[model samples]
Target: MLLPGSGSDDRFVRSAFAGPLSAFGITAVTPVPRPGAAVVDGYRAALDAAAAEPGPLVVGGVSLGAHVATAWAVRHCAALGSRLRGVFVALPAWTGPAGAAPAAQAARATAQLVREAGVAGALAQAAAGSPPWLADELGRAWPRYGPGLAPALDAAAVEPAPTADELAGLDVPVGIVALADDPVHPLAVARRWCAALPRAELVISSLAAFGADPELAGRASLLAWLKAGGR
Candidate 1:
């Protein structure tokens, strides 16, 4: 299963993974989130629901979704054993307490902007500061999330990430893809995850690569998985 970042849906996930993973016969499934729902809890529920589905499953996600996937694995290790094939965590936003992370700070700030200025005005502000492609992406995906986007960002800003010890405890093979220049998803954070996990592979990727090929996220992650010897 593939999970998208905050303000994104299954379409983005599908675009990122479907074509790339298909070559290896991996069918990616991305779920749609209910509007106005709590992001973390909603994704956790989705993860639990996925666990009941038959067949081995590889779980992965981007940004906040990546954090949720790892947190879910830590919370449900017993139930997910063997059935959980591998974990693909891309763009891990934070590592410790929520507010301590740059991404969380940015999320909180963006939430405030959206709340004060509304979506259109917020988009204008974001576009002024962001790369054209990023602004375009947010422009397209943010509206689908509706008014809940801000609150979701706020909730995610404060949501706890798996601790270093918790990360070290994971027994499953893990793959991580980090955009070296994305301060929001710091390469240091990704490196920390790679170092903490007993079994993990880390690949440094770039925004340019994604622009050149949207499927590169999955391709890079799959390579990381193969490097970790995932079947």
Candidate 2:
């Protein structure tokens, strides 16, 4: 199962992963969080839903979803046992605690802006400052989320990544994809994760590549998994 980033839903997740996973003959399942659900809570619920399905599961996500997936793996690995196949983490937004990451800080700022200006107004402000492609992407996504987007961002902004201890304890094969040119999803964060996790591999790509083709997110993660000797 794959999870979407903050403010994104099942549609975006499917768009990002279905093509690449299909190449491997794997079906992708994405869960959409209810509006107004807190980030950690919503994602945990999604994880639970995925875990309930029969067979071993490869869990993956982008940005906030990636962070949450790692945390869930740490918490549930014992109970899940071999049913947890692997984890594919794309664009890990932060290491350590939540407030330290620039992406979290930016999300907080964006949430505040959304609270004051509303989603449309905030999107306009963001579009003015963002590259055309990012602007277009957000323009398409944010409205669909409506008032829920800001709160979700705020929730993610405060949510923490898996601790170093958690990373060390993880036994599953792990794949990470980092966008080299994206400040919010720093390469250093990705490297830190690779260094900390026992069975992890990292791959670097550009944000533009991700923007142009979301399926590359899946491809990068899959490549990292193959590098780690996962079947």
Candidate 3:
């Protein structure tokens, strides 16, 4: 199962992961986000539902989605045993508490902007300095959140990702993808996660490359997982 980042929907997840997963004959299950503060719980519920299915499961996503997947994997690894295949984490934003993290601060600021200026206004402000591809992505996604956008962004901003300790407890192989040039999702955070995980590999790509082809991150992540003995 794959989930989207803060303010993003399953459409972006599908665009990022579907083609790459399909190349390996793996189906990507992208779930729609539940509105408001329930967003994280909703994603966990989706992971729970997917875990009930028969086949080996690989759960992952980008940014906030990556945090949720890692937390779920840590929480359920022993219960699920080998049925839990591995994790593919792309652009992990922070470790442990969300306190003062750049991504968290950005999300909070965005949420405030959304509340004060509305989605269209917030989007315009965000797009002014964003890369063209990122602006396009925000243009497509931010509006989809509608009235729930601010609350969801706030919830994600404050939500805690798996800590270094939590990550260390996960025995399954992990594939991590990071963009060296992306400041919001720092490469240092990704490196910390890779170091903490018992079995893991890291792949570095440029945000420009990812902007040109969404699947680049996914492909790199899967390759990292393979290198870490995921299959």
lDDT of 3 by residue, 1-231 (tens): 998999988988888889988999889899998878889999999999999989799999999999999999999999999999999999999999999999999999999999999999999999998889889989998887899899999999998999999999999989999999999999999999999999999999998899999788789989999999988
Give the CA lDDT, 0 to 100, for residue 71 in model 3.
Answer: 96
List where candidate 2 sits over 4 angstroms from the true fold.
none
Against the true structure, candidate 3 has what lDDT?
A: 0.93
Summarize candidate 2's per-residue lDDT along 31-95 as a digit string, tens digits. 77555546568778878987887887888899888888888898898999988878999999877
Off by over 4 Å in 1: none
Query: Using alpha carbons, what is the TM-score of model 3?
Result: 0.98
For residue 126, what is the lDDT in candidate 1? 89
Q: What is the lDDT, from 0 to 100, of the residue 229 in candidate 1?
A: 69
- Compare the candidates by lDDT and give the number of the best one: 3
Ten-residue region with minimum lDDT total, candidate 3:
140-149
Q: Report the C-alpha lDDT of model 1 over 1-231, residue by residue, as the tens digit.
A: 788787767777788888878999999888885555477777888887888888888888888788888888877766778877788888898786876688888888989998999888899998898777678788888888789888877887888788889998888888899998887889999999999988899999787876667787888888898788677
Q: Which pairs in model 2 have colliding backbones?
A: none
What lDDT does the true structure give each of the candidates?
0.83, 0.84, 0.93
Instruction: State model 1's lDDT.
Output: 0.83
In candidate 2, how many Å is residue 64 off?
Answer: 0.5
Please give the lDDT score for candidate 2. 0.84
The better candidate by TM-score, 2 or 3, is 3
